[model samples]
Target chain A: MDKVKLGKEQLKELKYFIYSRGFREPEVMMEILDHFACKVEDKLTENPLLSLQDAIKEAHKEFGYNGFYSIKASLDVFTRRRYKRIYWQEVKKILLSPINLLILLLIGLCVYHSMKWAYNNGFYDSYFNRNIVSSLIILIVVCTELIKFIMLPRNNGRSYHISIANTVNYGNFFLFWFFFPSRKLHSVNEILVISIIAVLCSVYYYITTLAHYKMIKAAHKDYDDFKVLVENENPLQ
Target chain B: MEQNQFVKGSLATIILKLLEDNGRMYGYEMTKAVKDITANRMNITEAALYPALHKMVADGVLSATTELVDGRVRKYYSLTKKGKKETANKISALRDALESVQLILTPKIANG
Candidate 1:
């Protein structure tokens, strides 16, 4: 058996392995591999029958792959739980914050005023009261808004997830206006204003969602390249 | 070897114990020590060792220092005070477990 030397290639492979495995500390990983190589070399000196490859493999097996995986899995579970706890804590902070709650209350008041206007003008009684079609449209709009509110961050950051959420939100609004009873005795000016709002929302939604989809695709591509790097380095060993 | 079917639970203890005895060691040295002590009966892969070491550091069970050696900077891990105390507890637990099992399995000798 040829003596196992820690060559440049092996170091590179070890570095890639540690990085791919999500250690985040490449310097520490290299140090560990150096020690592992030295130990394997020492074992080789004692037992000429034991090959370097076999020794390394034996050392790793004693460490136990499944054992390591379980530890990692537990850590992942712990981290996820910690993240959830922290997320809810942040949400609690946001909800409890007087300014945020005041803003939310003001938005609620705006929505209430809009509903009251729709009710007083006989728009709600005429168009929405008797027809299941109008009711369904209202339901769809509400559902879309609820979903958007849940999925999109409150701060209105232009993230891909938020953009997709907004698109669904606007699409529902457009559907609502398109299906609204236009033949009723009402002002065309109000209808036009609402239609314009819907159109603007739809345009923003469309552009943002497209940009978000492109970003999501790019991220996946980068991750795929990282996976390929791991496979190339390890080569089933 | 099969008696120790589950290895993950003992890894932190093993690492802490190794570092407690050795003063300071890197990932590979720790792995090698465990393997050599087990006489090739146990193995730990790079995948397992790095994450455990990283987590240990994160959790304050270990402290690390980095130095450049042989054209590469290597990080070495040493036990914290908490880690040393934890290692003592682990050793006691392991010892108790072994004793209990041995007591249960030992055959009584006939009085001659």
Candidate 2:
């Protein structure tokens, strides 16, 4: 068969090989194969000793399948490293940002003042005041904001999703704090409802974190596979 | 080997040069061309390749078109006017670096 005329079976095999090895771009893979075939055909016309299959095998040997994968892997590393570097740079900028720092300080002062006011008003001692609940609500909001600030630098698909879920969780916690009757909540039924909401929030946080962790793990695996391919293909060249 | 390290930094220059010569190329074709030209000495990673291409597109250094080929969508990248100018600048920069390095390494002898 003509080297230029790559059969469907060969194309399919090449595609599957690339995909199974974790190359995500199908178009790029096809283009590469087509280019390779063309080059081989050109080389064959000049020197007939280089059969199409032989040319392909030689080409493949020159650019080992694993080596190609490694390049992909190294690129992943480069991206992640670049992302991380950019993220930290952004974080440093955010930390140094006067407006952001001022907002955080203002919020901190407001919470502190509110806690002091609650104490002065004897809300902590009285059952009807709900000062403890309000304080808890403020604490949750502050922590949620802090979590968001920390996650902002690392923000990508997984981090973005996590931040959203955290926001929702905080919102639910706020609702439960304001609406749930603390005055009549000495009963078991009230306590059960509060406990369930708490449990639900805890579960949500666990699940979200777990999901993010799993995603990062998968990315790391793909990265490692890519690295292996590069090392195999270009061994100290 | 140190020259190999410069490959990453010079990738944009290399891509621009190739496009200058070839007029246009898709992602895989560009990569294959680089590999062939380098005689497989340098392997361009797909992950690095796409992001760089995308960034160049975003930066207006290159223009892209998506076309259906063999029942799949392929994105072709071609140099814009900005890309051509930038390529010229890169070539000049490379030439200057080569000259400077050669000047520094060349042995100076007393005039006879």
TM-score for each prediction? Answer: 0.42, 0.45
User: On a 0 to 100 scale, what is the lDDT of residue A218 in model 2?
Assistant: 45
Span of ten consecutive residues with least summed lDDT in model 2 chain A: A228-237
Superposed model 1: Cα runs more than 4 Å off:
A1-237, B1-9, B19-25, B36-89, B108-112
Clashing pairs in 1: A32-B28, A59-B43, A60-B43, A61-B43, A62-B42, A62-B43, A63-B43, A63-B44
Candidate 2 residue-wise lDDT at A75: 35
Per-residue lDDT tens digits of candidate 2, residues A1-237?
443444545445545544554554532343344434444455566567765556556555645446355444443443445334433444455557787557545545554455445444445426444556454654664676577447633322322333333223334445545543454344445555554454444334433333343444444444444334332222112
Quote the chain B TM-score of every prediction. 0.81, 0.85
- Give lDDT tens digits, candidate 2, residues B1-107: 56556777778888899999999898778877988998988877554576677578766799876554542335578999999999999989988987998989999
Q: For all the predictions, what are the DockQ values?
A: 0.15, 0.06
| Pairs of residues at least 3 apart in sequence or in different chains that clash in candidate 2 | A66-A229, A67-A229, A67-A233, A70-A226, A70-A229, A70-A230, A73-A226, A73-A227
Best by DockQ: 1
Lowest summed lDDT across 10 adjacent residues in model 1 chain B is found at B66-75
For candidate 1, give the lDDT of residue A124: 45
**What is each predicted model's overall lDDT from 0 to 1?**
0.54, 0.55
Best by TM-score: 2
